[model samples]
Each structure stands twice: as structure tokens, then as C-alpha cells.
Target: MTSASMISPGDILTRAEIRPILGGSAYGGICPAIEERNVILYSDHEVAKKFGYHDGWLSENDTLGPIFEYTGAGKSGHQSLTQSGNKAILQHVQSGRTLHVFTRVGKITGTDTKTHRYIGEFAIDEEQPFVPRQGLGEDDLIRTAIVFRLRPTGEFDRSDSDTISPAPSTSAEFVPLTITSDMLEAAAVTRNAFTSSSLRSRSNSASLDAAASGKIAPVQAVNVSEFQRAASAATTVRRRKALLIEAYVNQLEAQGHSVGSFQLQIEGRTTTLRTDFFDATDYTLYEAQGSSDRDAVRAAFSRLLDYRRYVRHDGLQYEPKTVALLPGRPDPDLEALLASYRISLIYQGEDGKFSSAF
Candidate 1:
């Protein structure tokens, strides 16, 4: 249908349909100015179509005065009902406006293992709006919720015409490369190599101790105190190394970066010593490692006689917050599209307080 036929001259049309035609032209595109002049002309077009008015067009001759009058009177009636003894009834109807839309998509029916028999059919409510009424009795206001079921037919058109068109493509643009299994496998191998190296270092020291014990049967008396001190130091070093690696991984993950392999740099090493890393991009590696260290230290320090009293004890607490900033207000086209869905901006707030300018 022609735009003129769909929207008559001097008749109201949504701001969305007229903006594009007037934006760059002489009419300097004042949004608020246009909205005030427009009145929503179409209502129950789908209902009209189902009752044999297939075109879904309303001529000037169509009597819409009664329907508009009913809506106006209903609003006044609701107010009057509230002021009178029927305040309960008014409240009942007021409650209906707050009813939420519940939608279920793709509900599949089936049996777990046995063959399931399909029932004949059942009535399904599509766009059900809650309506409230008063019951017959003093102080007895009844709110009866009714669901209106709409059968599938060629009546209502649910297509939205204002959806944004995708950007045009050029032949020179690079196509996205697909990640293959081989790439992931290679990454896994790299991680495993680091882990193996760390394990070997730890095992070699243990083996050396065992070999020394085997060679010296009834060995020369070495200081038991020295042996214990060395062993404790080695354990501490290993624990610290593990904690640092974990912390690094957690930090990277928290920043939305995937943890690949941990690289350790010794005092004079040119190459980074690789170690196995956990793959968790949703958390911070540094923070995780810090938390782990804090817990471990707290446990270890509690056993120490001299150092335990000096260590400041604090409970673990970690919270991450993210803030996003936009360049400007929402696009005019986008705002208009959202308004068609009956959504309105109620308030805009700053970091703490509400602002009326928005």
C-alpha cells in the first residue's frame, strides 16, 4: 500500500515513520514537537481483519468515536469509582496495568523413553491482557484474571518494519578465520611441557636425598637441625613460586584474557621459564593467586611462634566492578523504535542522584 493511503493527510503517524522523510529537509527535525501533534489512529486492526476486514485499513467513515469515547470514559469512571465507596473496585482495575508479559519460546513436548501419544489440541493464550472486575458484595472487590487466546491465522501481522539494516559489505574485507582442533592441541602441549619441567625439578631433589641415604649406610652424623632448616626453606620457595604463577593467571583471566602458560624469569635468564596455566578468562589471575597466597600464608603463619603475632589478620573479600561509558545519548532512530513498544524513560540518574535533564 502507498504511504499516503496508510497515513492520511492531517492524521497522526508515529514519529518513527516520519523522521527519515523530514530529518535533513526544511523541517529541522524537532522530535518533541512532532510527538505532541500525533495521535495513535490504529487500534484493534487485527480484530477487524479477523472479522472479514482483510485489508486492515480504516477509512474516515469508520466509527472510531465510540471506542475513543469509551477509553476516555473508562479513565474517568475508574477515578470516580476510586473516590466513591467502590474504591476497592478501582484498585482492582489499577492492579491490572502492572501485569507482566510472560512468553515461552520453543516448548518441545516428549517422553523420556517410551513412545508418547500426542493429544488432540489445547487452547493457547498469545497476547493475553489481564482485566479486573468487581464482585457482588460490600467490601468484596474481585479481580478475575482472564487470558484471551488467539488462534493462528492470517489476521495479525507481527512483523516489525523499523529494524536496523546491516552495514553493506565490500569484497576486500577479511573473512574470519576458524579456530581448529590442531591449534588447541598445540596450546595444550605447550602448557604440559611447562608443567612437566616444574614436576621434574621437584622430583630431582627428592631423588638426590634418597641416593645420599642409600650410599651412606650408618652415615656420618650430620646436623639434624640444618637438614630440617634446608628442607623448610625449599618447601617455602616452591610454595611461593606456585602462588605467584596462580596470581598471574587469575589477574589475566579477570581482565577477560585467557591464561595460556606462566612464564618465570630467573635473575639472569634471557628466556622465560614456562609453566602450566589454567584456562579461565572469567576471573583475574593476579587476584586469584593473591587470595590463594593470603589463605596459605594465614594457615602457615598460625603455626609459627615468633611471626604469628606480627602478621595482620584480615578476612578474604574480593569484589569486581565494571563501568561502561557511551559517547553520547542513544541514536534518535533507536529511541523512536523503542517508543513503539510502549516503553518510556522514567528517570535518568547520575552516579548517585536522579537527574531531571535526561
Candidate 2:
């Protein structure tokens, strides 16, 4: 990817492919914008401060990643999300827009000669999506911030694109350097010295230029307290979603339909795809999106598509109807959007009413 010195909230068209924009520039020559405005430039560096887990990236899995800590839509007491200054940033995620991501290379703070590695375009991880979590700002005020999970659009774009190659967390143990026969023979006489020397060399190279590598620096222990708080918040969201699924399942059962959760195991695949509800009578698979937000809805759509593909690949006896089940009615435009894709939407009402958009 061509490494532009800067990119902002609305710079790229949502339809343009990422490769052309970035020219496959993985890392290096690109620094976390040495500055940021509305569009978050996430270069693997943790902020210079020791306190808050304000801005950073967490690649939870190859497919699921999270960006922290932007305030969410003004639903809760998250004033930051509602501020006019951040409106463009919030819309990018809420509207299912992709953003450019770069990881830090050398120290990027307090200096003008910093650089970043372009990771690639990332869409917010749709499955768990964004969660409102407890976080303290630099000012120490209690606030709810939005943490968006992101997933790369294509393969890793940087030299260090191994995603977890060196392991991103500050807590990552010093991974020993791989030894070759040539180095082994020379170091045999002084193994301890060789090992320590090699480790230091690798660490130094990873830091990339001790002078420019800002103390804001690369990945931290992922903020222990923040990790715990995010985890707890996710658990709560899951529990609430489960209840909504149960309610929907009960409603279907009462209507004399036979429905059950379905799990599909594909040969040679370690992970099995699971569906929220499967109706045997109609061979319909329902995917549950606990929230009515855009990312969640879009993520549910992606999952349903994946399930449909995997089930077909599994050679099921019958084709299945894919429906997205939501806990509450989403935006009216979202319903129309779902219909446009030929995916049905069924949502629960505030009074526990259910309606379907087919």
C-alpha cells in the first residue's frame, strides 16, 4: 500500500479495496500519524501515560480484534461519543465503515522523526462488536467508553504481519531467537552469554531505533485492569443476549414449531459453527444479534452467511433459511438494508412483541 503521511475519517471510499489504498505497506515508514484527529490511527504503541487504557489495539484472535477506548453513542453517560468533535469517527464504525490501521515502529512521541507500519483496512469485528465498558480518562472521571473489535480485511500487510508473531502484549515473554548451526557452533563455548546477547539484539531491533522509539512505545501488558473490565462487560452482554435467545426460542416452541440449536462440524476444521436456532420443519437457521446497532447487525449478517456456506459445504440434506434475530427493533434503514440483502430480520419489541422482516 502506498504509505500516505496522513489519512483521516472520510478519506477513503467504503467500496474501494484496501490493497490499492495502502500498496501493501505492512509496517515501517508508517508511524501512528505522529498525531490523530477523528479517525483513530492505531499504530501498536500504547500511549505515553501509565494510567488509562485510552487508545490501543488488541488482536484477540486472528479474526477478532478490538480498538479501545472510544466513547460509544450517547446512550449511556459517554459524553465523548456525543461530542461534535468525534461525530465523524463514531459514524465510521456505526455505519459499518472500514478504517486504516497502522502499528508503531519506532518511538513516535515528542519527536518529529517517528514512523508507523500500515497493517491494513479493518472492519469492526462484528460478532462481539463494541462494548460499553468502565474506564477512567486521563482526567480520572468515571466514564463509559466504546471498545471496537476489529478484523483485518485481507492478509497481513506488513513484514511483521504475523499478527501474533512476536506476541503483541507487554506481558509477552522474551521469545528466544531461533538458532542456526553456524551460530550454534560458535556460541557452544559460551552458551549463557550467547543467549543473553542474542535476546538483547532481538529486543533492540524490535524497538526499532532507540532514539525515536517514544516512551509511548509499543504494546504494553494490555492494561491489566482494563482487560478485566472489558472481559466483565463482554460477559454481561453475552448473558443478556442469551436471555433474548431463550425468549425467542420459547415463543417459537409455543407456536408449535420444533426448533433447536444447531452445531455443524466441518471435516478438517477445528472449530464448529453454531447457530442460535434451527427450525427443522423449515430448515431455517437463526443468528442472534443481541444488540440493534449497525456493527452487531452487520456482523450477524456476516456470521449467517458463513454458517450458510459452511452448512452447504457440510452437504446438508436441505437448504436452510437464514434469519437474523435481534433483541430490539433496529434503525428503520437497517431493516430495509437487511431486506435488500435477502436476509430476513426478526426483532423483539419493548413490550416483548416480535416481528419479522422478510
Candidate 3:
């Protein structure tokens, strides 16, 4: 705890605790005055007042997970993070300091000292975390504000939420959706682009007349039956990963294996670390990663290692066999890496069957 690890998420230090560690009692939400300080105590009010609200309006939209947004510096027209008071905060991440996040636990109007609750600590998720997005300024002028996404580090060591349920019925087919341009047009038509029923009628008549005269290209009716990936790329990746886990779970259950998730509350931590699924019949804890690429595989490795400690903290009678449910077969190097750690790797194939990689 001597280094940055000392400052975990969900840690609310009293002045005595903080002053000794941070070397000063002058810490506040954002103190540009102390440029050398790595720790910044943030409250939601300050976020709303200083940079976020274009019109002094602070809502839940202010902070999403790992994403704390603010109006970019500048007032004239388009804004940039470098131009805003938030510039200091964004630039501070370059120092590689953990950002301590606090929210009001009592009345929102309560003072920072009394109301602030430590939610978690965050780190810069991307090399460049700030990007200007379209927004309105306090003056209601069309402007750009910087959106920053910060990933949560295990600073808080909070209990993990239970995210597993029973396996989805394998009797039902898992399908991917397909989308077509004509389907988009049909959706647009149903949404009513015209001003009134009269306009709609006229537009329909025009469409029929154009087809009858053969003056316009005929649009074939499109059936959008498959699940069109209507989500963002991040969402799509995560969804596909989730499906891989679900399919694996279904496969395991089809073989009469008892499956449930492991939610162990480590004695010392505020949050719990959970495994994706556990086999009661054999006491196997499965870690399902929605990603299989290098970085994700690396993270999954760390999680498995930490869970070993967590299991110890739980002091359960029997240790569970730890297995990772990966999206695909790992590269040889990665497979060897997992084997070196004695972690079992189970992957789904292109044919959708789950297989053991030993």
C-alpha cells in the first residue's frame, strides 16, 4: 500500500489519513493550484457547476461508468478540452495518477466534506481520453464538449455483481440478424416522414405512380429477419462474447452438469469477486471472457490469479477448479501461457461446439 495501490477505489480518507499519505490537507475537487498533486477528490456538484452543465443542469447523464463528461474549454463556438477548465483534469491523466471518484451520499446540497462518498478510482482508458462531441453550451449555443472515458481500476476492490442466470434454452436457435437498406426505408416510411395523412397519401400515390410509369428504380421489399447488429462495435463485441458464454453454459447443462455462479465475499473487501459459472457436481469455477484477443486474454489471466486470493479469503472447504471460457482457441503462445499458470482453457469453435483445449 505504499505506492498507488494504497489509494484504492471506495476509499474515503479522513484529513488525517489523507494528509499523511498525500502530503497535504489542501485537496479538493480540482485544485489547479497544486499542480504536483496526483490525488484529486471529486464531488458530483463540482462536476456540474464547473464544466459539465451547459445551462447549470446536472443530471445522471453527467457520469456514466468510466465516462465523466464535461463541456470542453472555450465559449465562442466549437470547444476543445484544451480550451476548458477540464483541460487541467484531462492533462493530469498523462501523469498516470489514479483519479479518485467521490459522489454525494447524503443530500445533494450537502457540503463536500460531509456528503462525499468514495465510489471508485479510475485510470485513463485511452491514450487520448478526450474527444469533442456535439452539445449545447450554457448559453444554449451549439457547441462541442469533451467526453472522457475512464476505465475503473481494481482500486476500490468492490464486490462484483452477480451477472449470471440459468442457461438460455438450447432448444431455441441462436441467430444472427441481417439488415438491408430497403428495411431501413420501410422503417423510415412507417415512422411517417410526411407532415400529415394527406401528405402521406400523396407520397404513397407518387410512389405507386413512379413504379407504374417505370420512371424510378423499384425497391424490393426487404425482410430483416436476422438480428442485425444494430449496436455499437464495443456492444457487438461484448454481445458476441456473452453469447459464447451462454452457448457454452447450455452445452454444459445439456450434459447434466450442475451450473451456478460463484459469488464470494472476501472478508476484507467491500465488493465481491464472482466467477461466471460454477459446476456444483465437480466444483469447477468458470470465468467467461467476452473477449479472446491478446489484451483481454491477459486481463482474464489477472482476474483468475486474483480470484485465487479471493477464494483463500473466503476460506471455502474445497478449492474450485478454475477454467476460462474463451471465445476461440488461443494462439499457441497464449495456450502455453494459460497452461503455465495451470488454468484450464475452454473455447468455442466456429461450429459453435464447446471444446476443451486441455
Clashes of each: 13, 22, 14
lDDT of 3 by residue, 215-301 (tens): 221212211121232233443454455466556666667899766544444433222234545666566666666678887788778
Compared with the true structure, the alpha-carbon lDDT of candidate 3 equals: 0.45
The candidate maximizing TM-score is 3
Task: Indicate which candidate wins on lDDT.
Answer: 3
Give lDDT tens digits, candidate 1, residues 1-358. Answer: 5222343233333334433422211221111113222111122223222322111111111221100100100111111211221221112122221111111112234622211111111111111111121111112322111111112211222222211122232111111111111111121111122122321343322321222121101111222233234333333333333333333334444667644322233332121122223233332111111122333333322222222122111231332111111111234453343244322211212342212212
Each prediction's whole-model lDDT (CA): 0.22, 0.44, 0.45
Q: What's the TM-score of every candidate structure?
A: 0.13, 0.36, 0.39
Model 2, runs deviating above 4 Å: 1-232, 312-318
For model 2 the local lDDT of residue 187 reads 19
Poorest 10 consecutive residues by lDDT, candidate 2: 172-181
Candidate 2 vs candidate 3, TM-score winner? 3
Q: List the candidate numbers ranked by TM-score, top first.
A: 3, 2, 1
Lowest lDDT block of 10, candidate 3 = 172-181
